[model samples]
Target chain A: MKIEEFSSDHLDVLKELMNIAMGNATASIADLLQAFGTMHIPHLTITDMDGLKSQINHTISADEKYYVTKQLFGGIIGGEFIFVMTDESAANLGHYLYDVSQPSDADIMDAVIELTNILSSTIISRLTEELNTKVQFFAPSTQIISGNHIIGQDETLNYHKIIIVSTEMEFQSHKISGYIFILARDETITRLRELIDQKLEELYA
Target chain B: MKFLVVDDSKLARLSLIKTLKEYEPTAECIEAENGAVAVELFKAESPRVVFLDLTMPVMDGYEALKLMMQIDSNAQVVVVSADIQTQAQVQVLALGAKLMVPKPINSDKMLGILQQLVF
Candidate 1:
C-alpha cells in the first residue's frame, strides 16, 4: 500500500473522522475557556512523506521552526498525532482565552500548550469511544526543530505511509490550524480499511 | 481543615473557593495562581489537603505533584480540571494524585470528595 494510493482511497473517510473528532475537541475547548467558538476542518488530504517533509521545511523558517508538541496514542486505532503551530498561534489562543483584543507573541507558547492539552485530550477520548478500545496517550513532548527537520524519517522506509488530517479552529475570530497524522504500521492498513468500511456501512444503513 | 487551591484561572479558583466554603464553612482556604507557588505554600503551611488544577502556567499540576511528593510523600493532592478524559484521569491517578475531580465543580460531587478526604 503506497502512501499516495492509500490516501487517495481513504482521504474522504479520514477527513470525516477528523471532523467528528475535532468537533468534540472544539466543544470541549469552548467549555473550558468559557467562550463560544467554531471549528472548521477543511478537506482531508494525504501528504506523502516526502511532500510533508518539504512542506514543513518550506513553511517554517530555519530559526522559527524550533518548537513542536508531539503526542502519541494507541488502541484499536493507533498513530502518531502531531500538532505543528507557529509560536504566534499559541499566543493567539492564550490571548483569546484572556479575551484580549490583540495577543502578543509572548503569550503564544503557554497558549499553545493549553490549547494542545485540551484539544488532544478531547480527540483521544472521542477516538477511544468510537473505536471501542482502550486508548492510551503519552505525555506530550515539546521539541525544537532547527531548519528543515523531518519526523519519522529514521524508521524503516516501509512505514512511510502517512495519513494527514488538517483542522482549522476559530476562537474569538482568531484562526489557528492543527494537523493530525495517522502513521499506520504495515499490518494496520487492512484493519483500518475494515474499520472504514464498517463506518460507511453504518452511515448508509 | 485548611485547603490550598491552585489554578491559573482566577475565575476557576474563585469558584472552587466559593464551593469549598459553601460545603465546609470552617474550612480555611488559601489560593495560589500556579503550581510553583502552590508547592511553596505546601512546604511552608503543609495544608491538610490541596486542590490543584491540572493545567497552568509556570508549573503544571503533574510537575507540582512530583515536587510536593519529593518534599513529603504523604502529601494529599486532588486534581481539579475540565479535562475529564479517561487517559488523563488514569495518568493523574497513576502518578499518586489522591483524586481526579472534573470541572464546573458540581456542588454535590465536590462535597462528596471533600467529605471522603476530610472525614
Candidate 2:
C-alpha cells in the first residue's frame, strides 16, 4: 500500500495502537526490574530497501554494538518484528535483568531471550489485537553484531515495499534504551491499509 | 447469562468487555489473560457465549477453541482477532466457532452477532 493512501486519521490509529502496546512493554519491563521506563509514540514509514537501510543506519551508528532479534509472524497478515539495542544499553538491560553488576556470558544471552519474548508478546500482540486480527509468531532468533550491518545483512526479507513501525523504549533506572521495529510485508501492508480505510469509512459514513 | 472473554492484553479485554456490555447488558462478564486460563474458566463456568482471542501465550486461540469445543460440542464460541484471512475464518469455523470478527471491533456487527448467536 502506498503510504500516501493512509490519511492522518489512519496514522493516528496506528500510533494509538503502538502507544498502548509499548506502554505495556514498558510497564512489564519496569515490573520485572523494579525500574521506571518510557515508551515513545511509534513512527511509521513506507519505503524501499535502500530507504530502510538509510533509516536503520541513521538509528544505529556504524561503530555501535547491538543486539538484534527478529521473529516472523503470520495468520491474517505476516511480517517481521525486530528489536534493536545498542551495546551500552544492552549491557545495562542485562545487568537489570540478571540483578548483577557483572553478568556472565550465559546470563547476558538468557536475559536477551527473555526480554525478546516478553516484548514480542506484549508489543506485537497488542498491535495485532487492536487490528482485530490474530498473528502467530514463529521462533524468534537473535544476533549480536555491530550496527552498520543490521539491515544490510538480511537479504532474505522482501524489501520491495515495506511498512516500517518503530518506537523508542527506555528504562530510566537502568539507563538503558532500545528500538523496536515491526516490518509489515508489502501484501500485509496493503491489507492493513484496506482495513484501516474500511474502518474510517464506517466511522465517517 | 454469563460470557467468557479471553485476550492476553488487559486493554484489549477491557475494550471487548465494553462492547459486549453495550450489546448484552445483563450478561455477567468474566475475563482471562491467555488461552490456557481461558479454557479453565470455560470449563468451570460453562458460560453461555465465549469471545476468544486468537494470539496468546501459554495456549493460543486455536488450541483453546478446540479444547472448548471438546468440552461442549455445542459451545457458542466467537473468534475475534486481527488476522481475518479467509483461511483463518474457515479453519476456526470448521473447528466449531460460530463467527469471526475482524479487529478494531465493529460495534454494529458485534451487536448483530450477539442478537443472532447469543440469543
Candidate 3:
C-alpha cells in the first residue's frame, strides 16, 4: 500500500491537521509537566509497510533505541495510534520537565506514558472533529526495548500498511520527537480514502 | 478589564482563551506569541492580570517576570505551564509570580485563582 492512494491535497490537509493535533498534544504535555515549553511541529511522511519497518529500524540505533507506546481507540474513528520516542530523548524530556539534573529510568517510563497519553488523546480528538466521526480510544499499552527487539522475526503476526506521521518537539530545553501511526484494516482504509477525497474536494472547491 | 495570555502554542492559546471567556465574559483578552511580546504588552496595556507561559523563545518566563517586576512591582502575573515539579514551581514562585497553574487550564482551578487575584 502506497501513500499515493491519497491525493497531494489530501496529504497536505492531513499534514496541516496533524500539525495542530501535535501542538495540542504538546500543550497538554506542557500542562501536565507544569513546565513552560514550546513544541516544534515536525515533518510528516507517508510510508508503506516495508517502508515503515525500515524506518522503525533506522530510527533505533545502538546507542539510542526507541520506546513505543500503543493505544487503541474505538468509536467514530477507530485505529491504533503508536507514539515512538528515543530513550535518550525521553530522559532529556523527563529531566527538563522535572527540573532534575539527572533522570531515573522510572522517570523516563513515567514521562513516556504521560506524553503518549497526551499525544494520543489530542490526535484522536482532532481526527474525530475533522472527519466528523465518532470514535473511541482504548487504554494505551507501552513497550520499551532495543532496536533489535523491534527487528526480530515474528512470523505469526499479520502485517498491514501503516500511516506514520512524525512531529519533533522541544520542551524545557529537551528535544523530543513524536510519531503517530494508524494501523487500519482494508475496510477502514477505504473509508478513510473516501473521507480524504471528500475533504480534499471541499478544500479545493 | 483586559487580560493578556502568553504561550507559544496556538492550541494552548486557543484553549486558554476559551476557558478564560467562561470566567471573564466581558474581559478583553489579548495574546502574545512569547514572553518578550508579553512583557511589551504588559507595559502598554497594564492588563488586569497576565497569564504567562514559562518556556518561550527570545525570552523566558524568568526574564519576563523580572522585566515586568521592574516595570510594575505590583503586577498580577500568573505562571501557566505544564511543568509541575517542586523545584520548577518554587523557582517561578521566587520570581514574583502571583500564582502558578498547570496546563490544560482547569476551569475550577482557574476560577479560584482569578477570584483570588481579580475579585
Q: Which candidate ranks first by lDDT, i.e. highest?
A: 2
**Which scores higher on DockQ, 1 or 3?**
3
Better of 1 and 2 by TM-score: 2
- How high is the lDDT of residue B100 in model 1? 87
Docking class of 2: incorrect
lDDT of each: 0.65, 0.77, 0.69
Q: Quote the lDDT for A167 in model 2.
A: 79
Q: At residue B41, what lDDT does model 3 achieve?
A: 95
Recovered native contacts, candidate 1: 0.00
In candidate 1, position A198 carries an lDDT of 65
Writing each residue's lDDT as its tens digit, candidate 2 over A89-184 gives: 777777878889988766776787778778888887887776778889888877888877777675755547888889787776587778888887
Model 1: per-residue Cα lDDT over B1-119, one tens digit each: 88989876554566677777777889888899888999999999999988987656688887898888889888888988645555557777887888988664658878888887887
lDDT of 1 by residue, A1-205 (tens): 4333453325555544454566567667666665445445334434456755665565456556544667777766676666666555565566676667776544565566667777777776765565455667787775546545536547446335555555555555465544444444444455566665565454434
lDDT minimum window of 10 residues, candidate 3 chain A: A35-44
Runs with alpha carbons beyond 4 Å of true place in candidate 3: A1-4, A36-46, A92-107, A155-159, A175-185, B1-119
Off-target runs (Cα >4 Å) in candidate 1 are: A1-9, A36-38, A46-48, A57-63, A94-111, A144-147, A150-159, A172-185, B1-119
- Chain A TM-score, cand. 3: 0.77
Q: RMSD to the native, candidate 1?
A: 17.9
lDDT tens readout by residue for model 2, B26-82 = 779999988999999999999998989776668888899999999999999998875
DockQ of each: 0.01, 0.02, 0.04
In order, the first chain's TM-score in every candidate is: 0.72, 0.90, 0.77
